[model samples]
Target: MTFKKINENEQQNIHDRSCMILVNFNSKELAAIKTVSGFAGIRDRIAVTSKNGNTKIKDILDGNMVDDNEDVWSEKAIIFNNIPTNRVTGFLDGLKKMKIRRPLTAMVTEVSIDWKLNTLIYNLKEERKAIAKGQFVDHK
Candidate 1:
């Protein structure tokens, strides 16, 4: 997996709208995999955006914050957005293997205190495989 820092200046749009970090992945590897899977023309590979401060994964996915339930918290939250479906499934599988609850956006604020700090930012090349089912899972 490869990690390349995006220029802060270039992320003004992302920053202005949300308290999130943005990272881009090389789609070449994903494109190759799609070819093998007979999805060669697929446009998107995978993208991730994380945010600190009180927030939920659902909010991130929906592009806005939602009312928190009694079991949820309002501070020091981590929100992971735009995770690919294959990756999400793999993550749930791994959690099941370790007897961890499937990560839920609603429960994240209640459970993970250092959500932003501990949340993964990037994984490229082989690391992607560790996180997802695709051949070139890159999250290192």
Candidate 2:
């Protein structure tokens, strides 16, 4: 069997091809969201709205986290916002495996969170398998 290598640029392109999903969860679910957000460049994409109506996730992860009450991550919060991609579904499943609630989005009714998240994981696995198969193909 012939083998091939994927270069850095190809890796970047593969990552770029992955899509992003904007997830919003109720304030009471902050800890749950933060725990799952650990997956996509998400621990960083995390953001929360303040009691006074200011958004703070970007600021906090950007090294602005402080002791100020206004900076409280859970202030009478609405919902945390995060943009997680296909790779992030691993953590989503982790929650499901443990029988915990998966973070719900403010969008996409009629479809369940499990269905949406599982679809992303399914597509990603298929893409990876295709790439792997190509890498092992004989090119003579």
Candidate 3:
């Protein structure tokens, strides 16, 4: 097997990377999450916040909920607060596991939320964010 050459940045990132607090929802997604929850290293690597019906936005945002070792890509990962992390990661996992029979597509959006086309953005801070259901048509 040929050895792959890793750049310095890539090597540094790998050393710094850690487990994540993943969130998910929906039928297929929920199933995958349940599986991951039983992992022996679950507590050390991943945190599941949306297993129950009470998946709150703040729970993912709260630094206290996640371990310091879970900061994989960035410092603090505060920007991920807008994501419905449970649904996205879980859904993707279901796709990989071939358990979700429903057809899915890459609905491009930065934030994961059940969205309406005519939705209003009351928060100027949040206006830059995108909705999960969006196809990115005419989206800025």
Candidate 4:
């Protein structure tokens, strides 16, 4: 996975491609927002707006933030499905090719398995309720 510096325009692109939200842990309300959005998985974009505001996406599979700076706080707007595997590899390759200075915390909004899990949970809850109330159960 590779991290790239994105401007507001790029941020908008990310937002357009997938569901996302701004994540700020420094403030209580923002943190709660993060929690809810994360649970929903509908918003894959995460913007960590606190501290230096410098952010980058971390590659959970690779276990790296994809940036070089460590002081900058990870204020990111995640793009869940924006970066595909090939694109991710290409990004890393581009960084190596250009010898660009990687940012501190990498920002990624790629869709995660959690999204499906959440959906499944929601479905199960609805189904359980239906069964409990005998709405869909066989009455005969």
| The candidate that achieves the highest TM-score relative to the unseen native structure | 2
Model 2 collision count: 1
Winner by lDDT between candidate 3 and candidate 2: 2
Model 2 Cα lDDT, one tens digit per residue, 18-117: 2223333465455665565564345443333333223233333233443333432321211122323243445556556656654332211122122323
* Over 4 Å off, model 4: 1-81, 104-140
The superposed Cα distance between candidate 2 and the true structure at residue 111, in angstroms, equals 25
Q: In candidate 2, which residue ranges exceed 4 Å CA deviation?
A: 1-55, 70-84, 104-140
Highest lDDT among the candidates is held by which one? 4
Look at candidate 3 and give me any clashing residue pairs: 23-85, 23-86, 24-86, 24-87
Q: Candidate 1, overall lDDT?
A: 0.30
TM-score for each predicted model, relative to the true structure? 0.24, 0.29, 0.24, 0.24
| Model 2 worst lDDT run, 10 consecutive residues | 6-15
lDDT of 4 at 65: 26
In the range 1-140, model 4's lDDT, one tens digit per residue, is 22233421142233234433243344654454445444444434444333312222223222222233334433222333343443434443444455533222222334332232222223334444565576652211
Q: In terms of TM-score, how similar is model 3 to the real structure? A: 0.24
Looking at candidate 4, the ten consecutive residues that score lowest on lDDT are 52-61
lDDT per residue for candidate 1 within 11-108, as digits (tens), equals: 11221222222222235533333343233122332233232223433334335533332332222211223333344344334445555332222112
C-alpha lDDT (0 to 100) for residue 32 of candidate 4: 48
- The TM-score measured for candidate 2 stands at 0.29
